[model samples]
Each structure stands twice: as C-alpha cells, then as structure tokens.
Target: MDGVTGLDVHTLGIIGLAVGIAIALSFSLMSLVLRGMAALHVWAAAFWLLTFAGLAQGYDENGSFLSAIIGSVLIALANAAMLIGIAMHLGHPLRWRGPALVIVLFLLIQVGFMVWPPSQPLESAVFGLKSIFWDGWMVFFLLRAPRELKAGSLFTALVFVIDALFYVARGLVSLHPEMESPELASLLTTSNYLFGILCTFLLSTGFTLMLSQRLVHDLRVAANVDGLTGLLNRTALLKAAAPVLQANREHTHAVLLFDLDHFKAINDRWGHAGGDAVLQHFTRTLREGGIPARALLSRYGGEEFLLLAPCTSANVAVTLAESLRALVERSPAHYAGEPIMFTTSVGVATGTGTHIQRLIDTADAALYQAKRTGRDRVEAMVSDPSAGDRVNEATSAASALT
Candidate 1:
C-alpha cells in the first residue's frame, strides 16, 4: 500500500471487498431484526451479488472462463437488486417481468462472450455498454424518487449520476486504438478497482445514514401519536395547543373535552373489541367533521378525546361542539352485522389566557356537569374573573409545562 496517496490498488480492492461483505451482513441483520423494512433484505442481496462479482473478477484475471461468466451474471443481478430496493423504499410498484427478461438476456450475451472471447476493442465496447445501461437505470430511478426523501435521496442520486457518466466516458475512451495496449488496459482496470472502492464506501455510508434518519422519524411519530385512534396523545396535544393558546392575541381559545356516553355498557354488551371499533368509528367521524387543520385533536384517555379550537367566540365553540355531537349521534358503528349506536357529551370553555391546563380544568368541570345533567349534550363553562386573573399571573410567572 502507498503511504502518501493512501492504499495501493490491491489494498483498495481488499478493503472494498471487506466493506461489501460487511454491508451484506449488516443489512441482513437489519432485515431480520426490523422485519418491516423488506427493502433492507433486497439491499443485502445486492451486496452479496456485489461480493460474488468481485470474487469472479479475480477468477477472470486468472483466466477462469466459467467463474468469470458467473461473475458477469451476478453483476447484472446486483444492479437489479439495487433497483428493486429503491423501488420498495419509494413506495413504488415494481413490475419485474420486463426488467427480469432484460437481465436474463444480458446474462446470456455475457456468457456467450466468455465462451468465445472477442477482441479487445469489441470486449471493451460490450462491457462498457452493459455497465452504462445498468448505471443509467439506477440514475433514472433515483431521479424519479420523491423530493421528500431529502438528503439521502439526493446523495444517492449524485453518486449514481456520476458513476453513469464515468461509465459512458470510459466506453468512449475504450474505442481508441491506444486503449488496446496491455499497459493501458491494466491501468484502466486498476483505476476502475480504485473507483469501485470509493463508490462502495460512499453508497454504504449514505444508505446507513438514510436508514438512521428514517428510524428517527418513525420514533418521533410513535411518541406523539396515539396507537388506538392515530390521533395525538395527551402530551402531544397539550404541547401543540400551548403555542396556539399563547399566541391568541385576537381570537379566544376554546378547549372541548368529549366523553363517549355509556361506554362501559357498550364494552359489556359487545366486548372490548366492539368498544374499540366504536371508538375508531367516532374518530373517523371527527376527522371528517371539517375540523380545522390547525385545531389540536387528541386521545386524552380511554373513551375520552380533547380538541382545542381557536374560535371567534364562545358561541362558535358551542356551535362547533353541538355539530360534532350531532355528527357522532348520526354515525353508527357496525360490528358483526349489527349496528351499535352511541353519543358523546362535549364540554366547551373559551378563555383569554396562555394557561392551557386551566382551560382543560375548566372544560373538564363543564364536561362533568354535562355527564351529571344528561348523558348526551354539550355544556359551556364561564371562567371566573378572579380565577382567570390568578391563572394569568401564575402562567406568566411559573409558566409550568408538562
């Protein structure tokens, strides 16, 4: 290995081979452990093909015709795996029939060439064209990926585009009569090995980062979202609603607490499964109830949900609550060919303060009142002046947060 410019050609090839093996192993573990990301399995297979291709190249250098043919086929298969993996990641439907046939035809042609090797220029042309075609396919898929993929997608695209262009240029250069010389051919091969090492390192690191980023995003979503209803959890709701309430300079903020009436009876009659279905049914109605996107909707607890709406006035809050109540009353949950009717009692309270807890407490008081007076109705609570002043002062001083 060179000491100044880093490792020599042989060392770089060894390192590249090791990296390829490590990538295959790492991705295999990721696929087995995660299970959900099937694309990692595809990528693992791709790296395995890459490793085989490398080994086959060594056999080819030793004049092993059969091994070289197998390696050539593995190269095409590797490219195919990479393409399929990208498709899976992007939520795209992969129609493999056409591409599979093309790969088969490519393999046959390469095997035929190995059986009766062509002259230097002809062989270079064939090999270069094959490389360009597959690299171009990669570039096409990367370009078509959604913009939301951000850093990972962009980095992968750049690497593929450069690799594709390099193959094209290499093909054009190989047409020169000078390229037929043994020294030139050997230099070209060595340069390619070096470049492959760089490509492998870049691709493996980029993909790992992409996987890490996706894991982080999924974790964040899981933390904030309620598993049963797919709504925000209580913590997330309060965290989100605080800013809206605090910044309410012109409009009053209203908190509406909803509780399903006779929920335990539904559980007792229809079982836990039926109760769950009813809850999901009500959530669907709420989502379709034309609630403003800015409003925070959350699963406060079992059979209870909270909505913080920035309304024009208390009247608007009451109207909104009444409309939601009516919507739930009309929609019925169907379980086992039987319709289960249910209703929700809502408590709406409008206030002019940054203290979200105070608002929730006031709304909860009204909610209990609704439950006591009648099972299915909406109730509004007026904030006491002295209580409001104390809350505002405490909210300004302590600014306690959950």
Candidate 2:
C-alpha cells in the first residue's frame, strides 16, 4: 500500500525504528535502576518494552489468536507484577503469595484478550495506554522523591508519553478522517511520516522539562536538610515552625523544648570536630525510630532541639518530652575513641492566649527549673490541663514556699 502511494515508506520506517529503539533502551536502563532499589522494578520497566515490542510484531501480521494470547499474557503479567511490587515497597512487601494473587488477575485478562484476539486495531492504543501508566508513576516520583535520580527517571517517562500520544493521534486520523481526499492512500502515508517527525521534536522538549524539574527538586532538598545529619536545619525549622506557631497560638496547642546537658563542656574537651560527629550520630539515632506522622523535628540551635507536635495536650507532650530526654541520655556517646555519657533536659508548655514567643519563654523557664533542680529531667510549666489552674498553682507555691 505504501509503495502504490507517493509516500516515503523508507523514511517512515526509519523514524519508527529509531523511536522503538529509544523506548526499548529506556525501559532496560530504568528497570536496572529500579531493581537495584527494590524488587519487581523490572516488571514496571519491561511493561513499556513489551508494549512497543507487541506493536512492532503485531504490525507485521495481526498476531494469530494463539500469538495474541501469549503476547497479552506477557503484557498483563508485566503490569500486575509492577502494581504488586510498588504496593509492597510502600510497606509490607508481599512475599511469593503476592505474585500468585497477581498472576490470577493476569490469567483472567489473558483469557478475555485471547477470546476476542486482534478484533480492533490495538497496536497504537496498546502502546499509548501502557506508557501512560509508567509515565504517571514517573511524574509522581519526581514530585515526592528525595534526590536527583527522581528527575532523571522522568525524562524517559516523558518520551514514552509523547510516543504514546502521537501513536494514538496517528491511529485516530487513519481510522476516522474529517475530510475525504481523492487519493486517501497518499494522504494516510504522508501523515504517518509527518507524525513521526513531530514526535521526535516533542520528545526533545519533554526531556528538557523533565531534567529541569529534577534540578529544582534537588536544590530545594539541599536547602531544607542539615548537611551533616540529614535532619532539618535551623533555618528550615524556623520556617516550618512559623505556620504551627500561628495555628497553635490561635487554637491552644502544646510545645516541647529540649536542650542537651553539658553539651558545651563535652565539645570543649573533644574539639568542635568531634562534637559535630556526635551530633550527627545523635540525629541518626532519632531518625531511626519513627516519629509521629504529624510531628516536625527541627534543630532550634546548637545543642538544642524542638519537636513541635500540634493538636497535643500538655500532659501527653510532657510524657513525650521525658521519653525523648531519657532516650538521648541512654544513647552512647563516643569521642576521641573514648565513651562519654550525655543527657538532655526538657521543658513543656501549652498555649492558650500565649503567643509563640510567650510559649517559648514559659517552656524556657521550665527548662531552667529542670537544670536547677537536677539535670536530665523533664519540667513542665502548667502541669495541669487547665491553663487557668497553672496560675493558681504558681501563686500558691510562691506564697507558701516563699
């Protein structure tokens, strides 16, 4: 048909071949990276490859019923495997039992496709839909991922999206034309050649956006996290705290403050270099044990930390503060190849009509009280739940003990 028409079949074939190779290589590379990160990554990457492969093969001859059945089975299995693996990595990775469940779904879909088999011209649609799934995931990861790799992954995904769209458009134009031409043959052939070239240009632009997004994401992360400990830095903390401070101040919330005991003396004895090492180690320890889903952990200053847990009661905040203090005190400290012990003091205060600044002042007073009475303990201003009751307690204590 292409030969009878005045279309450049040679150029069309070359363009298609180039795109197919690019898509295939992308899958192989990404699959390798995903596999290194977690199991079933290959399944996700391979789905894109197999979809293109099916299109290239099916175009030769509408795959026979048996061939389509086999091809469909492979594609379905790949998709199912991808969904299962990603769901597992989210937490509670599925064992062998999961693959068994996924295979059942694959077999069911395989049976359906086998019965119908090549009823519609599915080549372009097959390629497009499959790429959309992978591309969606790539965009999602780019948004949420912690580092640079997230951006790189997106470039390949964008190429697939463009390939998928052009193929779908090509299919639509070939099947349903708005205007009828005297020589439909030449029109169809010429359009196919033109679309392929268009795809190449789109692919280049999409990749540019993908890489740019990655660079921006990485720079933002570097600014937020402390270089040594990978914890949020002081600047990051203040910015993060601003919203919470306003929220709790407007609607009564609790705050817990902590300061490491004898931190200065230890740093003075074992150089600032060793001090930094110890601090980084301590940050790691805190990060290891999971924090509350809503909790924000930030470094307030040197030797001081803030755990701002919103919508919490004063009593509960005190309990948490004490536990954190105990944990830090128990953690082993090594400097200059020698074991050293350290402890922290905590102060808890709840906001009612108090501003964030006033809350910090109250908490600081309680922290000073902890140090004065005995280090390595938790002291809370307004130990009672009722904010009004705290003023009464302070007054009574001052009058009698005065």
How well does candidate 2 match the true structure in TM-score terms?
A: 0.52
Error of 1 at 92 (Å): 3.3
Clash number for each model: 0, 0
Which one wins on TM-score?
Answer: 1
Candidate 1, which segments miss by more than 4 Å at Cα? 1-16, 57-69, 108-133, 136-149, 384-402
Q: In candidate 2, which residue pairs get closer than 3 Å at backbone N, Cα or C atoms, i.e. clash?
A: none
lDDT of 1 at 373: 84
TM-score of each: 0.83, 0.52
- Quality of model 2 by C-alpha lDDT: 0.58
